[model samples]
Target: MTTRSRTAGPILLAATILVGLMAGTFFIFACAVMPALSRSEDRVFVQVMRDINDVIQNPLFLLAFMGALLLSAAAAWQSRAEPHRWWTWSGCAAYALVFLVTVVVNVPLNDQLASATGSATAARADFEDAWVAWNAVRAGLSVAGLGLLAAALTVRGRR
Candidate 1:
């Protein structure tokens, strides 16, 4: 393969894998984590969420989440001269939407959850429903983003 194609191969692969991990993480939260947390007492729930927020900031998850964006953008840029450019570009767009939602909706809620100082009852009342609802949106967007990345990879493969 040519140098550009060779480079594109790894870029696409990394982007796809990272995006997939993000999708799976969100899916797990939607399917199990949040629901289980919902059943916990308010203090336990809030504390767990605070701990989780801290834990999720670890290097690996950060690499996957942030790397997906960087890699997707790189993949799209690398594919620009190719016929399948749209595939990578669309995938990047999908991931961008996911990022947008996370930043705009979720991060503030998380910050709020973290800052809450009063009764867990009050905290849960303020944060839980809105957080869960927005999280569901994040999960859906993550899945769609992953699918788009897979489609991009398939398109790249066919070339």
Candidate 2:
């Protein structure tokens, strides 16, 4: 392999893994956490979700969250000369959408949910459905990105 392709291989691998981690996180929330929360009492749902949002800001999550974007971008750039570069480029594009949705839609909704007052039921009503819907969307997008990255890694050197 060429020097750039060799370099791209490891960076792309790390990017794929981080993206997969994030994809699994969103998928778990969509398929399990939100579904379980949907059946809970409003107080329980609101409190648990608030706690989750608070706790999810720690280092490890941030690493995966930010690393997925940064590394995927790096991987795409590094692989730009490879014949199979389109997969990495497309994967980065997909993750870019995931990042955009998280920032634009999900984070703002989380902020809105955080500031909600008066009743737990009201907070849950405002937060749960929208959060669940967007989580599902991000999950699908992240998974697709992961698939594209993995394809880039495994199908290297091909046209």
Candidate 3:
């Protein structure tokens, strides 16, 4: 096996784990949390979402969120000489999209939801549908990235 193959295993494994954690977190929120909140009054929805935004910023989530990108980048870098390098590169790209969507789309919506000037009804009106849509998109991207990294592991040393 090539040197890259030897190093690829661990880094790819780490990336997959982090990506999976991130994917599952987003997936759960998309499938469960938001839907459940949809039944509540707009005031409740706005309040709960604001609370979630505050609480989710903790160290553990940050570690997984940031580590997913870093390790995916490292995995892609290490896979440069491997036969399955494309898999890691693609996985990295998908995660980058996930990162971009979270920052570009979801975060702004979260901030808008956090805006104190808005009425809860108005805030929920502005935030709900768009946030849910982009969240599902990011969740899907994270899952795709996770799959690609898993594929990288599967084809690690193949010619």
Candidate 4:
């Protein structure tokens, strides 16, 4: 393989793994932890969700997002002159779509929830509705990203 292809392949793989981890975290956070917290009458769940939101808004998440974006972009650029070009482009497209949905739908909902009153009972209905809607979209996008990642891997292996 050419030097450029060698470097780009590992970077693309790392990006795929990063995206998968982020997407997996979303599933675990929204589906398992949040649901458990919401069911409890204790305020612990509210606090947990708030903490989670804060963490999600932290610079680390943004940095990871940016890294994923860059890696995908790099992969696309290299793929233009390499084999398995479609896999790289498709993976980038899927990751971009996931990021777009997160920025557009999920982030706003999270911001609203963060500013909301902390009373679990009062906020339960609204939180649940928003969480369900946002998570549904997130889960769908994550699955698509996973599929694209798998395709990319297959293509890379064949090269």
Q: Candidate 3: how large is its RMSD?
A: 1.8
Q: Give a tens-digit lDDT track for model 1, residues 1-159.
A: 788777988998999899889888888988899999988998899999999998998999989989999999999999998777887888888888878888898888899999988899998899888888877887887788788778877877777
Model 3, span 35-139: residue lDDT tens: 999999988988899999999999999999999999999999987877888999999999999999999999999988887676888888888999999999999
Best by lDDT: 3
Order of candidate numbers by lDDT, starting with the best: 3, 2, 1, 4
lDDT of 2 by residue, 43-118 (tens): 9988889889999999999999999999999999997777658999999999999999999999998888788987
lDDT of candidates 1 onward, in order: 0.87, 0.91, 0.91, 0.72
Q: Which stretches of candidate 4 lie over 4 Å from their true place?
A: 1-3, 42-44
Residue 88 displacement in candidate 2 (angstroms): 0.5
The residue-level lDDT of candidate 3 at 108 comes to: 90
**Which runs of model 1 end up more than 4 angstroms from their true locations?**
none
Over the full model, what C-alpha lDDT does candidate 1 score relative to the true structure?
0.87
Q: Which candidate do you rate higher for lDDT, 3 or 4?
A: 3
* Candidate 4: C-alpha lDDT: 0.72
